[model samples]
Target: MVSVSASLAIAATLPARAEDPPPQLTGDWGGWRTELANRGIEFQIGYTEEAAGNASGGQHNYVRAAGQLVLGSTLDLQKLFGVSGATMQITLTNRNGRNLSDDAGLNTLQQVQEVYGRGNIWRLTQFWYEQKAFDGAVALKFGRVTLGEDFAAFSCNFQNLTFCGSTPGNLAGNYWFNWPLSQWGARLKVKSGQVYVQAGAYQVSPRNSDPDRGFYLGWEQTSGALLPVEFGWTPTVGGLPGKYTATLWYDTSHANDVLRNRQGLPLAVYGGDPRREQGRYGVSFQFQQQLTRPDVADPVRGLSAFLNITQTDRRTSQTDNQIAFGLFYTGWLDSRPRDVMAIAIGRTQVNGRYAENQALANFNARGFLQRPEAEYAIEAYYNLNLHSGLDIRPNIQFIRHPGGITNAKDVLVLGVKAIVNL
Candidate 1:
């Protein structure tokens, strides 16, 4: 019924005139018959490194790599193809994993640390088929596609925290391409003005040499009445393009990946651990405001401020309760074209603790988005328990008034943080 309603809405928008057909062999969908011609590429490169002066044993240092690439087309597919349209895309991230401190909680050499140790990455960001309704009110997308759940296009990123970068986004990840991101499956979505909805099924990721048969299913909704992200109401203003948005997403899976990419090459599983059935669902709220003028503005001509919070409930007993709050701002000085900078902060707390790994039983229990990067962080819990103290991972080595486990010397990040779109 909802699909039918969306189709009607889309049909209402498209021109009823008998439009010229689209190109053949290319599998074109819409706009192409009368108007079509668009293509482009995008890229990003970054570098970062950090070293603490002192620690429980020695100093700490962390290095990372991040990058992306985007190829877009303006040609409509419907006008070209009688059925589905075609668009091609690809994305990848090459990263190395490193351990913060050795068992002694002291300085560990980079050589001794293994960022994924002997691991590598290559994600096929996007490659799918799309079809637009004659009315332009509804569109159908198949193949590896982004489920644009809500503010995922804006929120769900935290370069500062290692945990915050889950494959990148999740409507399954934010960045164009990354790991533990969206699964390979079929998805359907609907959009009508300010309201949106979605349904999807995915082959879940697995662990180690063993694998599981896991899959996903879910739905979501969003409205402009209240911006849950920022704790208040804001509207995207014609004056500033700032507005508030509220979003809700839920997903459940009872399947897993057997291992293999489209080409039959071995690919990693999606998500599942102690529990045979993997379940993950969360809700988010956000608000954004762009402070700047179009014609004339400061070097920092445009400033966008946004915040989001999400909580998760999982069916797996090993899975920890999760909640995340993020605050961020981005812009450039004097509106310099290539000169841009951003600061983002997030806080997350899990049921199990690294320090309590002994009591918890499973220390290797994986962590996700805001996974307790640092104890006694700036936003979450206040006051430090000097007795039990707090723990700082490789990523959270820098933020704070130094109260957790040791002196300020132990938390300092300095180095190159980079990404490239190729």
Candidate 2:
């Protein structure tokens, strides 16, 4: 799908370079002299597979593959009129999930059932348009954009084994929650000097195809020392840090209610028939800092740390109330060149008493989701600039449900991974 908005084209007339014109004077636009064209395209493909053996919980096997294509036409930096840039993107994915009653790779496979919407394939994950930023500073965007969907975690699933769920219980998460999140709205971006902000809203109609009004609001900013946002595309405890700065953000979501009947009786949850309305409301926060000691001219001398906290409550009888906490850090063994190491640890707790689908959320690197019950993860990754498309990562992940708690032998997962970024 392509969306085009035409406006005033850039002006094309220039005087001599004598001393410079007024500061507020807009630059020249048009003509072959200052025209800019992007005419660039890119594509990425990923595939992964995993299987378990032995007496742990039921053996599990999974496979996921995705591909993305992006197209962008060039634009003139000097032209000020009739939209200067245009971009379109497309994605597709297929994931197979199942738990085996016996050993998966050991011998013959027995009973294995698909989990949730496992067999379902998303032929098109995303389709959107991106304009040349209004200014080199504010990147105004709109359309059906993915929300805190947890994509980062989806990427590290197999290709790289070191990192656990960046968006654990999110839509693309492994254990419980699974769903590609989307928002229909407008987003504005502005930046000046070393400071910038991203804020946007999503509209939700009560029914699936109905026209209910819903909104998504988020704000993030960065300075010489701080980088903070209400909700990032990916969920993580690793906040952006600076030698001397602070970053912070807050956000909220309310789903549209299309379940009210004409007499105000509850009917269906998503359609616009005489229905009752309900929605999901939640907020999130993040903080980061770079610890420096005395006279250190370089940022390599300081350690950085951050924390994230979030909560959700839906006015439905199904599932409600969720909380999560995460901590992360980036500190070098010493102040020597680009030698850096990072660690991220996280814990997620859902209302264990509920029998609803609350335990289905997941957390992935792309964003934060509820994830499985009693889930904790610890990971370490080291950057290897010399080893092209490679990273050294070691990680430990624990997962379990109410059933796995009493057995003591619970669920334990450990692995080492290498990343090849093509």
Candidate 3:
């Protein structure tokens, strides 16, 4: 997650120079970008490309590329029309490409590329209106929104999905969709000096992910509501800042039991009768801290670490729990202030009930077998900032167990990601 204070510090160091042009691929539209910002309308456009392949240990070796285009705009009500404390944001996204996970037959739970999702489709990602009141202590937002954008907001500096976005959303994807797939939702937040509380209610519907229904806003087949609450603390340690957040989410929807039958026995052994349950829930904790302060000459360079953990109801979740931690260093070399290096490790634990079911199925179908358990992944990358608006990251990942299945061999993956601001 990017801290507000850290963003401010970076901005403070980049004072505009009359002689230098704006740092954008489009060259600030010949100063039009600044003119529009002054008038309260800010537009943004970007594209990201990821190419990945499994070099060893998967079912097959294949290379694939995924691409995403994002277009967005933000309008400030106060500056545009003299309306106080209100703003509106709109974003559109398009994704195209084949997924490496499926292509290589490496059943890794977390995706290899953060940009690969519901591929080859266009969708309205975000359209929200926010208003602030009570001297900016309270805020309210509503409309098509993704819960991850506000709560448990994690950075996407790494290529792996495990280290990107909200942990709960990554673990409980069936119910909690992350970015590029939003639903009707609203959020309210209240903040004080160093602490804050926030809550949200969102529509839960699987149909929202269907590309054919990309623009569908109807409540048809709506299962139930997804409600979330979070509390956060921001503190300064040794003059450096940190943020800690805890979140709880409950989906008041009917969920099918993963392993149980109507008689509460293993579904595979009980005539394949499925059992259904109401409500699904999860919890997550996230922490990001600046470990080393940057020197006065390079306010944008520093060392930071992050940890995220999430647990979901085992009976209803495919992956019951996930934990990830990582460290990142910016500007390790004074000459390359825009460069960053990071390493992260993540583990996804299979649900015990699901494992038992798999074991039973294997025994019945194959006569002898091992059950699924957990998968572990570790990744490291160096982000080379080619320019203010361009970045290229080369990364590698090792997977101890590709699919949580005991027989699955370890896998090694190599990839590169490129992001451009247009």
- RMSD to the hidden true structure, all candidates: 14.8, 14.4, 4.0
TM-score of every model versus the real structure: 0.51, 0.49, 0.94
Local error of candidate 1 at residue 217 (angstroms): 18
Better of 1 and 3 by TM-score: 3
Stretches of model 1 off by over 4 angstroms after superposition: 1-86, 92-118, 134-136, 145-151, 155-158, 162-182, 207-235, 242-280, 292-300, 314-332, 335-338, 352-410, 419-422
Instruction: Output the worst ten-in-a-row residue range by lDDT, candidate 1.
Output: 1-10
Which 10-residue span in candidate 2 carries the lowest summed lDDT? 6-15
**Tens-place lDDT digits, model 3, residues 1-422:** 11111121232122111112224567678889889988988776778899999999767899999988878788889999998999888888888998889888888878887788854788888888999998889999999987787777776667788887678888798889887888999999999998999999999998888866667677888999999999999888786777899999999999989999878888867756678888999899988788886686664578888889999998799889999988888888889887888899999888888888888888899898668888888999988888877778899988887678767888898999887766
Query: In model 1, how many backbone clashes occur?
Result: 68
Q: Candidate 2 on 256-305: residue-level lDDT in tens?
A: 32233446543432223443333334344434344443325543334444
**What global local distance difference test value does model 2 have?**
0.31
Candidates 2 and 3, the one with greater lDDT: 3
- lDDT of residue 91 for candidate 1: 31
Better of 2 and 3 by TM-score: 3
Candidate models: Cα lDDT each: 0.31, 0.31, 0.80
Q: Give per-residue CA lDDT, model 1, range 242-332, as digits (tens).
A: 4444444444443222222344332322223322334444565555556554335432234455554444442321222223333322223
